[model samples]
Target: MGLAAASSEHAPVAACGFAEATAVLRRLTADDLERVNETILDRMRSRAPMIPELAGHLLRAGGKRIRPMLTLAAARLFGYRGLEHVKLAAAVELIHGATLLHDDVVDGSALRRGAQTANVIWGNKESVLVGDYIFSRAFELMVSAGDLKVLQILSAASGVIAEGEVLQLSTQNNLDATFEMYLAVIEAKTAALFAAAAEAGAVIAGCSEEDAEALRRYGADLGVAYQLVDDALDYSGAEDALGKRVGDDFREGKMTLPVVLALARAEGEETAFWRRVIAEGRQDADDFDRARAIMRRAGAIEDTIGCARRYAETALASLQDVRGAKDEACLRALADLAAASTRRSN
Candidate 1:
């Protein structure tokens, strides 16, 4: 799964809603985000020249920084006024950035965020080492925040994310890979960080255990929905909108939900096609288009979108139980963001 977008069939309000909701979150947290950005730059300094260079290549590449924004919003939603959330938020983003660096190395990706990947420019070893450096820096920031539970959440998420990456690598190109397997990979690799980011902010804000748990679930569900959209977009997404090559997952023989569903539904020659192209990894130039056609015919992509919508709905619901802050506007914005996440085009 990579950069996600709404399918053309559901293009109108889904895309617009996502943009507007994201903007609301941005507007709400703009001041703190500025501080978080400054902290990110300030903390990244080091004696090693290549450290900053390799790290900045991707860091400055313009990611949405949504995870950190969640941290900021979660803190403010509880009326906590302190600077620790800033450190925690920055740490969340650094953790995400470090993961991306490592993911590019593992996936051998050439492009990210519409730019050449750091691994492509700096080489795999350099990218990996810098990713480690960034991880260390993230831990440093987490420690500086002085919250043990927050540390536990973020650190445990890091380990789970690593395990998820390994699990995905192990399942690649395996026709036997089930929907359960794919979900496990994504839940760990992607959802864990989202969970930790939101929960960490709430914990730092001193929210009750119940509210903290709710935010955690909210983040996890949103992450799953987001990754599901990413998987669908790998086949059907526009290249300009996705900021990366479409069909890269197919080329890599990843066992995403779409492929799993298509394979499950395939019969006769279609089964053979999936076997050859997916399990055997023998794709030609036209294979991707053919795969897309097959998924479309099988309702695999549509069902994947439908599945993502369900999770996004659950994410929205998770936030409902929480007692809203005085303004309650942030609650609406967060709900809107979760509701529209399944329709993201970038």
Candidate 2:
């Protein structure tokens, strides 16, 4: 869900084979990314002065930039050498950041990446407006590229993501949620953007329609795998390690994979506890420890990890059709990174 560190430096070396791929893309796509960054800054500056300043504050926070990196990697792997990939990559990041700005408001979150959330510092109205501003600016950049297909892909993804968020909201604490329903929600909310990122890259590279389909699958599988690992970490990781409080999902009444699976397999009083307390959002002071123990007993954490691994495997398998290139290897490495993200104890 966020960046992390491993104890031995070797672990990152091992975990971030995909990260190395991005570095390679950085060298290959540096000029384009630079231009895109400059254009973004200039476009934001054209907004009323303070709006750009506030939005820019969040942009400068320096995230992993993985979405753009995936775009660049896809283009390079498909043997594309053009400026449009850079614009699409920026578009990807802008869309992602816009969602985060809104998500902080929806979740009532106070912090992100160890800094105060824009909504926390600036208020919900300002955060939402700035997020919309970024969304419009991203489209303006995309329009400059003159790629109708790119526009369609991103626009569709935006709609799917919104639907996913609302689906989750409607499903909150509804313990009857099935794994199929969960997958549907995640595919829309999380995987659709990944599909767009890869599809946009292939479009920029002038790939065949079939190859474009493959890239989309790659992104979708990776997206599903990434989110599963994030959910697992909520149970397996410590508060400091997770960069948020442990059991925060429980407190929020948000039912995740672990909770769903655990409830299905729970026994006797364990089942009653979840039904009455965790799902009902009515836990007494004494329920937390017992509920946690019940979850551990149900093998919820193991089930989540197993499901994430399956998606990682699916992601790697989707790369089989692509010809081997620097970008292809990087894509495989990205798959490895997706697998590794699920494997992490942090």
Candidate 3:
């Protein structure tokens, strides 16, 4: 999903928690993030001007930089003072950026972070090639970090993300997609990177295997909550705040969690309506409103948010045995951010 800022007018007060948590993380990682940004810009340079231009367009666009922050925070939590985490953080961001470029092309999306997507500005072929270039850069960064375990974690995550994307394509417009299937798709597509980011940070820090595993679980749970919230927001969020039209998932005929939940509760006519709109791709303008009404009646959105909160709780719990006061606070705030993601209007 495209990164979006909460609109002042449309965003709920509860959503402010995410902003606050993000601010906390940003403050904590400001210096390292600066270095990460520099590394990103440095790596984006090439003999071909368009290579930097196209990648820079999206890189300079605003985002919370949450994944890389997780990397830095994870390393710091374990008392790592080395510079390897900086390169690793940049690599994490490059991996994320590569996914976004390729994802926009795959989703046929035009907007990202309230701006025209790289694919829209540079064409799909250029976007794809540049994405490949960025992926290569990410691997280079990993090698520069000189950590075999870190490389293995990230490389495996990259493969899992690709598999998740393919799985999502297979499930698209298939209304019968189960909740378990949806969970598996998101776990692969989103959580793998998060898990790897945190785990690699711990590896770089030379933390205990158990501590590293805890951080990995924390990141994975956080990522699942984040994606579930995004899925819910597509049906309920403000257009400007979401950075794309509301109900885009519906338009795309993707069977996200809310749809999966609603389908499980649908009656005869409701079942037919979903089948016609989602499975058949025969939606009309009013269909989105009707779908929203049905989802509300079924409490699908609320249930999805509840599910997100559960994962957020699990994420927080995963950090319960961590050793530092400051690190613990930041990790808890990140968990709160995960909960707030579902509470957002954007």
Candidate 4:
């Protein structure tokens, strides 16, 4: 569905660009985010020195803190006044950091967010161990929150993320990978944490079960849109904009949505070319360019963006029943941000 035009009362702020939405959220939750950041630093400390060293490396690396910000923003939307959301937001950041460390090791990635990956500098063993340490810290914070429901949501998300990773491993280079399979993998790998973060926020705020569920659905759809855009960017985005080289997924033979779509539209020789390069891992220097050309010919990137747009619309719709004018407006801005994220260059 096309975005509804904002009424005149909201016209000045109606164009909820990603940066503007983030700015609004930051303004609304500045003090809370400060506490969350402080908590993250304190909890990341360990006598093991290397643990802190490695964990701090990625923590200091520039990420938008979007996931944790979601938690903070969601809590604010419900007028939560207690300090529990602070710990929960920090826990969400820890969980996200741990996943990044582990994901680098699994992907054998050399760079992240325009910096050397912890695994690249510290070695795989250190990366894995440090990731585990951070995960433990996350759970400790969750326990400190003393909310059993929060624990259940986050812990389950952790497991689902692992399962998603393993599922992606199983599907790698498999040309026969289907759209449903890709969606399932992204839901588990990426959306699960987002769902947990938003749900935990609403739960802590004492929102009704229905409202909490709406936040969870919003997060899940937003995450899928985010990942779809990321995947498309891997093939088409500038290196500086992406914080990594373009075609990284193509180089790794990962079966992203664009590749899946391109393969589906491949003709005789084009089919053989994809199978040889992807399934057989026979890529050459020129293969990435060729892959891009084919994907463009198939309109894969546009199709992927279209898919992301649909999810973004769904995310916006999920917030319809949310109460409170201010809360609904903030949530609507967030949903708009998710949709706008798909169109960003970086």
Candidate 5:
């Protein structure tokens, strides 16, 4: 998994190397990501004043832009030189931004990107409406890309994302949630877009189906790894370092992987505690702390991180057959990113 797999061996793949890999990828694709940003700004403009104002607040927020960068990197891997990749990359970002807006409203989140969420500042109704607006803009950008296959991939991913969120809603507050159910939630709600983002770029680059599938699998595994770490971080991460409240998922009764594993390992009194706090949604101020302590004792968080590392390794393996990549550094960074993503503090 070297240049053949994106510097998988060239860089440190330890959990502590996540930030280093992220910075490397950012520096490598700074120019392409900037163009994607420009397209996002251009496409977000609307006659309604509130639309730009609200959209700008979130778009200007300091997100990692990993999804869009996946699109750009896949395109560059296949030596794509056209502006179509830019449009698709911006569309990917728009899709992510729209999801965040909607998710904040659904989760009743107060903070995002270390700032007040749009839903907190503009109201849930406004946030939801603007999320719809952002979705429309993303579709517009996809259509402008004029690649029917890419459109199909992204539109299908969008639908799957919606379906995943609904499935998560159904599973919320259920102490009986299983590992399969949780994996389905993260794969669809998170990994589907990552798969589509990478595949879309390959399609635009006119790559072979094999290479396209490789990138898709790479993104899929990397996305799962990243999301698993995200869920684990909810219980273990620093609020300031993670850019949000640490226990939002617990308060919201999200049946994330860590919760699933912890509940599976619960004893008699532990089961009742989880039922009260998670199943019945009667969390007191100390519930989150108790939940974290329980998870640590059960090694749920450690197992979740370990699982994430396995997925990241799979992501690196998926890149084994990709060919015609012009920049070995981009590929190497991606492999390292997959390895390091599981260890993210955020």
Candidate 6:
């Protein structure tokens, strides 16, 4: 189906985006998520003297907590009642936090969730150390589950994530970044953690290898869709709604999909405009407007959205092997939710 048709057909079935995610997530109670979150926070707080303060600063900022929720919800859907789910959820959240700390430093981000970033409040050295503290605490918390498989899975994903970040940095201004390269970087940098989250849920729940693998695929595809839309929104999203400065990637000389497509279609002055923006990193408000116009003229936004829809479809298809009746429905809804979220304002 085309984008409009897909949106219309899936609207009722998927519950749009946040509504669907909220409904599926409701399977796990607030107390359940909060209990796990508190434990995670407490463990971080209990860390040795000065490090706790640094870690505490970022933790207090608070986020949507979507990663851990994915893990907890998957475990609950599979009938897992053990406390291990709590630890695993905390582990995912901590891992996520560590990445953000590092990302803020790399991106020179001053604010996050309407608060000063650790790097901005504290020094980069302190932010990096506190990030390490969270990583260590996450591993320590993981030991309570006693699953070496989970540890190995998370470890490998973490390595790939770091490598992907470096790769993205390397390709920052090189407008020649291929579509394949873009997908690979996203899978490693962003999707790997999502894959680990869902796979760990199944592992802790004693799910079969097949079912666990299926969930892993689901998370990976969902993450791809999530990040693709994120990059797309950087061009079109309102600054206030995005919760970050707009056109940041372009200003940073980062060549995202929108810019890539615009470059490919550019001719004459348009091509030189892209070169100045991407190569020189010279951008202003009018530059952002012109870039958006260029992207629209080149059909990059629509193309990128189409790719996101494909990933969402793949995510939905991956659930075919899952056995439970609700599992399939919820997973399908989750896929639709992912797809619908691409067009969201926030």
**lDDT of the structure predicted as candidate 1:** 0.88
Pairs that clash in candidate 1:
none
Worst 10 residues of 5 by lDDT: 1-10
Instruction: List, residue by residue over 25-72, the lDDT tens digit for candidate 5.
Output: 888779999999888888778888889889999999899899998998
Per-residue lDDT of candidate 2, residues 1-346 (tens digit): 1012221235442455444545655665567667657766776775376577777777776665667767777777677877888888888888888888998899888866556788888899999988998988888877777889988988898899989989987767888888888888888888899889888988778877877787788889888987787777776777765665666667666678988898899887777777886568897766766766777888888889899888877876666555433353445455555556466544
Model 4 residue runs over 4 Å out of place are 1-13, 324-329
Residue 67 displacement (Å), model 5: 0.4
Collision count of model 2: 0
Which candidate comes out best when scored by lDDT? 5
TM-score to true structure, per model: 0.94, 0.86, 0.92, 0.94, 0.96, 0.90
Comparing candidate 3 with candidate 6, which one achieves the higher TM-score?
A: 3
Cα lDDT, model 3, residue 9:
29
lDDT for 166 in candidate 1 is: 97
lDDT of 4 by residue, 192-265 (tens): 98888888998888887887898899889988988998899998888998887788788788899999999999
Candidate 5 or 1, higher TM-score: 5
lDDT of 4: 0.84
Top TM-score hit: 5
How does candidate 6 score on lDDT? 0.77
Model 3 lDDT per residue over 102-155, tens place: 999998898887899998889999999999999999999989999999999999
lDDT (C-alpha, whole model) for all candidates: 0.88, 0.74, 0.85, 0.84, 0.89, 0.77
Of candidate 4, the 10-residue stretch with the lowest lDDT total is 1-10
Candidate 5, residue 286: Cα displacement in angstroms equals 0.8
* Residue 13, candidate 4: alpha-carbon lDDT: 28
Q: What is candidate 1's lDDT per residue for 1-346, written digit by digit as tens?
A: 0001221225322334677888999999999999999999888899998987887778889888889998998898888899999999999999999999999998899998789999999899999899999999999999999999999999999999999999999889999999999999999999999989899988999988988998999999999998999999999899988889888899999999999999999977999999899899999989999999999999999999999999998987788767534335566667778889877776
> What residue pairs clash in candidate 3, if any at all?
none
Distance from true location, Cα of 134 in model 4, Å: 0.2
Looking at model 1, how many pairs of residues clash?
A: 0
Candidate 5's error at 182, in angstroms? Answer: 0.5
